[model samples]
Target: MLTNAVPTTNGPVVGVEQGAVRAFKGVPFAIARRFAKPVAPAAWTEPRHCTDYGAYAPQPGHLDLAIEESCLSLNVWAPAADHPLPVLFFIHGGAFVTGGGADYDGSFLAAHGPAVIVTINYRLGPLGFLQLHRHGFGEANNLAMSDALAGLDWVRANIANFGGDPDAITLSGQSAGASMVIALATLPQARGKFIRALALSAPGRNIMSADHADDVARRVLEELDLAGDAGAITSVPLPTLFAAVERVSRRLADETEAGTLFGPVLDGTVIPHEPREVFADGSLCDIPLWLGSCRDEMAMFLKSMPPAAMIRTTERQVRAAFGEAGWERLLSCYRATARVDEDPYEALLSDAFWHRPMSDLARVHATAGGAVWLSRFDHRPALEPFLSQGPTHGADNACLWAHLPNFIDRPILKRMGGPMTPEDIDVAARFQANVLRFVTAGVPDIAEAWPRFEPAKEPLAIFSQPFHVIPLNDGARFRAWAELTARPGAVA
Candidate 1:
């Protein structure tokens, strides 16, 4: 299935045609050594066949999967058209420990809009993010983010050959990937590489400080029986290190206040300060921003927790997220806003982790003269028979991408896809068009005058079957959160 060669800045690479799109998979964007910064990929004399996806970074719980250290590869999906088009660079979300670009297929977005779509893979877990400054590997703590920056750098220098506009780049991501996009927008090294960003459910408050990162590193080292030994850490088998990472991660999961298990640290080089601190300082990118979270951001994760424990955790997080004076008011608002009987905990998690931080960041970005467009994805298909939970995290992805729930596996999905309804197709089409419109013009072309978010007029574009705009603070819980967040020293 090899097609004509596309000449890049480094070398000429070849791709294969899949349906209406040309896919270039397993393309190396950078080369790296363990616990070292990435360097440019080696030059090749002949065209490199990039048809199959490369290896993913080694992670625990997936021992059967291939793993490697030099795993900074990316996949490109471009339309068959000859003219240049806009580019959408996506990063996958796996809580910064697992997941890779290969998990996603971007051909739908590529063919539908005739735009080039690039999904990249970065290092994960202990190998990528554990702080090692105390042990002398200070530069490698944020290798995952550095890998993403290298991928963006590759696109900036070489996307033109794939009929993509280098200047019209839109950085888009979900979950952990969304956080990376926000971090890139804040960092100086990644400035000017992207025109705008589309952040889908960014966990804006999970970044760890250097000290916390060091603590996690020490625990992992102790678990692996390599305490205070830099040589063993650098040379240990990945499986042994990954098992230790799992022990540390499982132990920290109970500490809800603890940040992500293995994620970007504010190491003073890559990520200068905490994300909240950066957003508060109004130093974010001044481009147009489109960001939002789902209605049930925690349902997927809370499935394992007992009802009483979940309720207790929600109650505790409420005060930390908001403040002391209005804890009762906030809980009352949450209970009143619960759409279902078992929804209060989901509501609490959504506000504390997703909506509240997103709103805060929107305010700061607007204050910095950036146009902010916010939304809430509340579309739950009637055909979701696998789980009763409504519109959980990453649910909007079904309508946004070609990988609709109907097209996926499971007995329920098969039956649903067997007879796709007009409403389903219509909704999917509308979302894809709006997303492409934003990618092309830097702002979503909706029916109404999509107002930019302000302190008073917190406008939001709600994406439903009938997409429309409403004040972000419309509901009781939202109003209460808006008031609580406006006060000094709110954590969310």
Candidate 2:
């Protein structure tokens, strides 16, 4: 069912699909940004062939990116229109700097359930972020968020022909992508525009202080060979700026233990408040959620470090990075909780970054009476650099892509030169099956009525060799982090 031109509410649309499994690319969901301004819908003259994706929105250094005007486009894959289906919108993560939606082929996830799968590319790094760009007469402060808003609005206005129920869209993302969901959901301008459910994997803090935005802008400017004080950087060649920002981001990611730093900022227009504050105040979209991090989140952070060093990292190190009382508190939790001292530093990395932030989000969401499902990935990928990568950030993608649990010695994927690995395929099927049921019915699969957080206790369903439950928030290890990093602020 490929058509060269189909009439849409916004404009005349022409799209093509390769096959039953993969179709719908280069669909224009919004007007293109021209000369620093997002224009109104421009009528099409020719039957715009949308079968192939349009030029990727300008990104820092992605190999496929072609800088062009027609970047506000999205690609979709869904069940044939013979039936109505839930919709899944994917946001790619690249530390808010790199990645294009075109990279993630959605045919795999489309098979998970009866839903339209959408993969997108949005403005990244200097182009999309840079709230401080508005200072001293910059074009826009929330460019990245504005682009995302346009994409979501497009989904809301026109997902029906693709056999997708726009009302049942579930927004999901990983890494920087995950953080984008958090920011958009918190932005009042985005309320009810698109998405009925939220799924964030390894989300970062979005609402930044003015100081934070200034620092980020300075960094970007400095990399452009201009004064970091924000002068003449924007005047530099766009491609040069993009390339320099990309290099500086890589260097900054290595400069700190915290990894990358590009993220959403509170610019008063698109972002009126901090996301953590929005979560605390219960203003976020009230919907079913699936949220959690991996067991060895720090594994990826320690990948370059000697495994021998990782195994022997001491409390002295943790304290130095954090503080004295904090280190001791976290150490107590690690030894008492995981029940394995195989790697002393494991707890250090877990508490400071993954465990604390993840649990805090879960607790706030659950406490707000939102239906939040918690999960912890304990599966270990130990085949190729598996131990170092562990079941880190994109572990869930294994389930989403190859349809397998975290592979131990096996690649978590079996016979992938074919369809998804049996295990991952099963997970992809079941994951969306339940979520679809929840989106349509308002109850996240009655049979899967997961547990809720109880005060200091955090419960997460484990998707591993055998499905089991693991107490996360209340676990001694997480509690140690809660104590160590506990602040009056909710940004954690």
Candidate 3:
């Protein structure tokens, strides 16, 4: 049965109950005005009915959700348990552009895990990531990062009231959200807030240098015809602001690698040092990490590209980044390892952008004496479009949240191929069980079979029909990618 009211730091909130799960949706975690830091919401005595989701952060109009500036809210799903449970704090991925806490329904994970699940909404696009500190917008740099921090603060202070162990929070995220997890793990302010981290399909690089962010900010301002009038930014209508963001992003796409126009900035104040540097130096070795990428991450993005053009473009880029000899060696390795009918270009792009960087991070984290588990989602669903793509980007989400019926038809899963089969459900159950183990015990239950990542053996769990852990055997392929990623201006 649903609780009459759950006390929070700011006030009491009423939630909906379904079977053994209690879900509190659109609970305000923080309040913020445009271009300002988030602050605690006003306290209230009357219980707030957070039965419906709050408006999404002002973003490019796409998802048919209400957009507003006061979007710093979070959702929670907890089992009907008396004792406090471990909390899984998940961040949604939308390439720092689209997505919201409501996009993911945590009821399934919460019920099955018997753990509290928290999903959050943070600012997005120009409204969130535009770094304008150098342009006299002091409170604007890394606003989304700040929003995440604010949410964490709220959780740490009040999650226990909702039947969660505040001290045992596991920070988990995917894609752009995964990058945020990496950033938070490295941030000194975020220490002690979460016990462990899980990152899936984190981009090779999402942090933008302050100078680069400044350039993007200036371009955005120029597009809006408010170049020198930084004060006018706060008053610009959402549509006008987003239109300028789109224009600036299009112009910068060709100028920058991967068209990454906006993301967290190394403002020297919020994020003092680079995340890779922190990971390499062993500073973050104490926290346990579970991270991985899909087998073919780029297939989703390259699906629309004509086969002939895809091959030509991939060849031109590969040859330019890596010499002809390097290209041949890489191609040979991929031809041997890639799935049947998988495009060489798609495989190469996936490796260069997602797989290689994840592997490198795993090796360094493990080398530094950190407890880490690495895995790859290789299970291709027995469905149409996804069968052609073969475990493409965001496919794991389909398995991870398969228990949530409402979630099954969401874009991340539906577009990847939904209406899961019996085989697919079996795989999902196994994946969720392992994830729950990690969230509760700080280590996956498959530890006996899947040993901690070691640089020498490079042990990695392959999540497929017959899930198994195997030491990485493709040194040649990774070596080729390492060289390409090391090249200047390479997106990897």
Candidate 4:
């Protein structure tokens, strides 16, 4: 019996049914050309078999894997074609360079609920985000985001066939994917694609101006030694072009300390304005928002720094960036909150980069009379014995999705392998429930009510071993950093 057969807006797709859930994989929503805007896929009359995941965007390390230009596809998981369910539209994150929607499994989430989940794959790295249209490339600015828009359009047009309510869509993502959600929330083009958004660990500061984007593109050309011939950037061998992207990215990171080498740029057409400015002005669509960061968002990166350098150079750099007065306040705050001497640097960075920026965004949104609930994911991983610290960047992902990321190395898993403790199990269940509830009902379904964020009450959902809510714990030092960032030329 071909029970999984479903009709999409453009074609008939045959998926696989297992128990209550049916999944369709590698369904092309758009056809993409290298460094160009994605176009609608050609319609098909025959049933297209969508049983396996499709090829993902090209990245640096996966050279041996078969990469392709037509990689704009989406995977869907639903209960049945007859029931209308809430839709969770998810975007995957890999620092804006790598990652496929397949890395995150939505079957568990969809099977346990009255909801349908869709995960999309967009262009990454130079192929996706590099703004090369100035040199005759076609709409190269924010190509990754453009691909996301196209996928959202497809969902709006065809999710009904997958048992999803097109009007009750929740856009959700983490890390770089969270950044895209924030971008869509601010951009005029994405006003009604999703009714609400759940942005986890949104790096609201990644969006750069058009001039900076063009500068990066120019440096990429220079790195490839094609400075005089900009058009050659598109014609170079794929491997060589990827190598040049790596070199240019590493150079940018070394010199400027940027998190992502290529991402959503403030091109006048695609992204109208700097994202921070847009969020601050309360220009985002009036959608309920659930967003926050990990308690130790920077510790994952800090683990790689030499212990001595982290102790000595990190604070010194902080002082150099801020002033003497600012440094003193930051030190006081760090000392007040630090668990150990080595923790001060990590705390400073965590607040400055992730926590503070998001807090500011919440403040602006709440002031604009939007419904917002903020939280901090404090649950540490039960795995990974090599690290001495608790829940760092990407740590909450395992708990949030109830599955480990595809990139988790087998050796690391083996050495630190352990069953989820009772505490871990409880937290994961509650966290997943709250997320599903928020997507379905516009509020969390935890044991206690998740309060709306206000300046005085400052409610937050702290997801620890026994998940609970609390008043804002970030102290005056965090507020100082937020104020400093609001000033021009301070941080972005």
Question: Listing every candidate in turn, what is its Cα RMSD in Å to the true structure after a full C-alpha superposition?
Answer: 3.4, 5.1, 3.2, 3.7
Residue 131 error, candidate 4, Å: 0.7
TM-score of each: 0.90, 0.81, 0.92, 0.89
Any residue pairs clashing in model 1, and if so which?
none
Between 2 and 4, whose TM-score is larger?
A: 4
Please, what are the lDDT tens digits per residue for candidate 3 over residues 1-492? 456799888999999886688889999999888888888989999999998878887666643454565688999998878789999999889888888887787888998888999999999888789988888878888989999999998999999988999999999999999999999889999988999999999987747788889889899889888887988998987888888887787666566543557777889999999988898899888889999788878877777443312234345556777677767878887887765777776788777667767888898898988889989998876655457777887778667866632225454223443466766877778888889999998887555888888877778898887888877745656666767667776643
- Candidate 4, 293-351: lDDT as tens digits: 88887777676643312223344556667777777877777777677634776788777
What is the per-residue lDDT of model 2 for residues 1-492, given as tens digits with 9 covering 90 to 100? 555455566566665554555467877665544224344457666666667766766664443446555677788876565777777787877667666666666665575465688877677667676655544635557677777777877777778866788777777777777778877777776777554554545643444565556666677766765663455654566678777766765665545433344577776766788776777776653766666566666665566543312222333345565566566666665555554434446646665555556666777876776667667766643333434566665565544544233332221112122333555545445555555555455544453445655445566767665556766645455455555555443222
Q: Indicate the worst ten consecutive residues by lDDT in candidate 3.
A: 305-314
For model 4, state the Cα shift of residue 226 in Å: 1.9
- Candidates 3 and 4 compared by lDDT, better number: 3
The reply for model 2, stretches above 4 Å from the true place, is 17-22, 31-37, 60-65, 81-83, 222-235, 246-260, 304-322, 332-342, 381-388, 403-429, 438-444, 447-449, 452-457, 482-492
Query: Which residue pairs clash in candidate 2?
Result: 101-120, 128-144, 403-423, 403-424, 403-425, 404-423, 404-424, 458-473, 458-474
Candidate 1 lDDT for residue 76: 95
Q: What is the lDDT of residue 438 in candidate 1?
A: 88
Which candidate's TM-score is highest? 3
The residue-level lDDT of candidate 1 at 426 comes to 67
